[model samples]
Target: MSLQGNLTQQVEAYHNWKKELIRQIGRYRLWLQDNNLFSDDISARIRHGLELLVEDELTIAFVGEYSRGKTELINALFFSEFGQRMLPSQAGRTTMCPTELFFDRNANENYLLLLPIETRIGDLSLQQLRKQPERWVKHDLDERDPEIMREVLGEVARVKAVSTAEARALGFDEGMLEHDRNNPGKVLVPAWRNAQISIRHPLFERGLRILDTPG
Candidate 1:
């Protein structure tokens, strides 16, 4: 099956699973309510399990240090020629925040949404992004409106130009730290602080999953 077909199958399977689970829960809850048997232990455990199951969705996370080719891997794996344009993967710290990718259906058309971790709608170029590390903000899912999730993703996925200052801020410096083995008085400098780019893909359906985490 094609990637889209496979994704559709997975999503359908997940929906079916979720519906069955909900039905079971409702049946159990109704039985308890009708019997007036509200055992605290049983009730609490069921509630907790339901909460966890409700939060369970297909989530694939890709993580790596700076310049570790995480973006390239995604580009090669899922996107075709047209889809490639939707996700602009490059060789730098291109992504500053966690990005989520999911498929959306509207009027019988399927489009991929790339959601970012920001609220304000502002025009940000890649070049400008590379210069200013502070321009990008961490995304808070609770504070954001669900209605605008697609729009936020659309904007965030646009490739912006990186500036020299932004590049430095992203730890793109060459030889900033050097280890001097010959000199007794030489101080050891750390090479680069750990930086991570995460991509949450909807490929995994209905079970929280993580893939490719660096130690």
Candidate 2:
């Protein structure tokens, strides 16, 4: 079996185990209720615990400086089935912003949501912005074509030249940007503040979320 197949099998097995465990817990709770062995507070606590278990997600994060192979490792480990690099991995800083990969069960569709760097000027935090769908630029994904997917995914690494004042206004440190002779008085910075990629991969569908920190 391919790596993707193996991972899918392992995730499915774990999912089944969780379902069986939840069923066993439910039965125990019922027994407790019938025997009058648990108080109202105990029952509530048990219910809360079960809710946590059901809602739990597995998050794996990769953190390092530029050109550290974080993105490359991610492609090799989870996305090799694409027969090419799924995420943009190159010789230099490719991931311009913190990128999240997961499957949104609620949406039930594959798409890429990009938060513009201009949004950084707002008072809202990243977490708050996520709730405001209108604030993001949505790109519907076509997984059937790997070339199309690659083209869309490459947007995460896109950068644009901006004036120093503009970069500062976007919450970027002017000192971090180097002076370029090719583009004097212009600072290059990431076009997007963050990227949220939703796909229908097996591991992701099983509640796995991968965080690729900025490179």
Candidate 3:
């Protein structure tokens, strides 16, 4: 057989295997749901993992220095189909906090959840925030309206005033503080610690997730 023929066969076999794995994951999810396989909390987690697998979730994480173009990479790679910047990818330091992009078919409407940076004062970790959705300030996303979408997406850049001591407790050091951003009684900081954006996109519909973080 020709070399090209052999390579094609290998590629086809890999895809076939992947499809079978996804199907099995789906079956497992159904089995868990139908049988009440575990406690409510445990089951929820197990089911969530299963669903992502069954849906063939592909998560890409971009992490680098402040001006490293991580957002642009995400836009060009996945959101370019929209022919416009969906996220705040621009020339300057755009992404002030970590952001996650994904789609949930179970979600009835588009939304963005901003978990406050102040929560760190309560010693609540990211895992704790997952269980405490009430702690996140939720925003409705309107993709159909470009103006609204722009306003909504701009929330990532929201800033708040915090005392230097409070900022230090959040792990910011003197060297990290921007002199020009300081106010008389407080230092400016990103209003949010993290963001979860749920929107309907073809790539996300196919179970793709993008994790963009500051490096």
Candidate 4:
């Protein structure tokens, strides 16, 4: 066979595989929707599986010095309803840790899943511990226990009514001020990494699915 013919064959094979995968995803989505599988118990795994399909998914990290309105932008884009409650945006370390928000059809409960850099679930919020990544853990992606993921994320989402002094101690307050001072110039806050996630929700068929990450 000619080399060009072989190349064409290979390309055709890849296209077939891609089409098959998409078809399978569509079927699964329809099945899930019919069965009403959009529950917390299954959302995380469904999300993980969908994320693995993209060949070159983009990871856009919202990076800027402190208080550059990165979180605000996220809020505007992904989290507007939560913003109205004056929710704890003052946690100081908005986007302190690298947060990868992706789409999962199975996530019914609106909660955060926290995974420690290591294997310790002491009483620490993932968002709060952004400045101290080394304190309570090792980063282990091979571990796929949804329960563990839930534990970690739950801790991260547990926001407290922080006092002014407490806020200063954590540097969230300082970061905001620094962001304001640096105005037009870039503000340097904790570096936050993010991923572009696209997933088919069981509820929303066709091109409709869950998209975006947690703020």
> What are the TM-scores, per candidate, against the unseen true structure?
0.41, 0.88, 0.73, 0.31
TM-score, structure 1 vs. true? 0.41
Summarize candidate 1's per-residue lDDT along 8-69 as a digit string, tens digits: 58767877888899889979988998899868898898889888877766666788785686
Instruction: Kindly list the per-residue Cα lDDT of model 3 for residues 1-215, writing each as its tens digit.
Output: 85434634554565577688768876876787688784678767776875665566566689888878888877666555557777787765678789999887787567999998878778777988888889999989887775677678888867777788888888777567554344686777778899999888765665667899865
Each candidate's clash count = 12, 0, 0, 19
Tens-digit lDDT track for model 2 on 1-215? 87666766777887898899899999999899899898989888998989988998878799988899999988897777789998899997789989999999998999999999999888999999999999999998888998999899999998888999999898889898755467899988899999999999878988989999875
Ranking by TM-score: 2, 3, 1, 4
Best by TM-score: 2
Model 3: residues >4 Å from true position, as ranges?
A: 1-17, 22-56, 81-83, 181-185
Between prediction 2 and prediction 4, the one with superior lDDT is 2
In candidate 1, residue 75 scores what lDDT? 54
Full-model lDDT for every candidate: 0.46, 0.89, 0.76, 0.41
lDDT (0-100) at residue 38 of candidate 4? 59
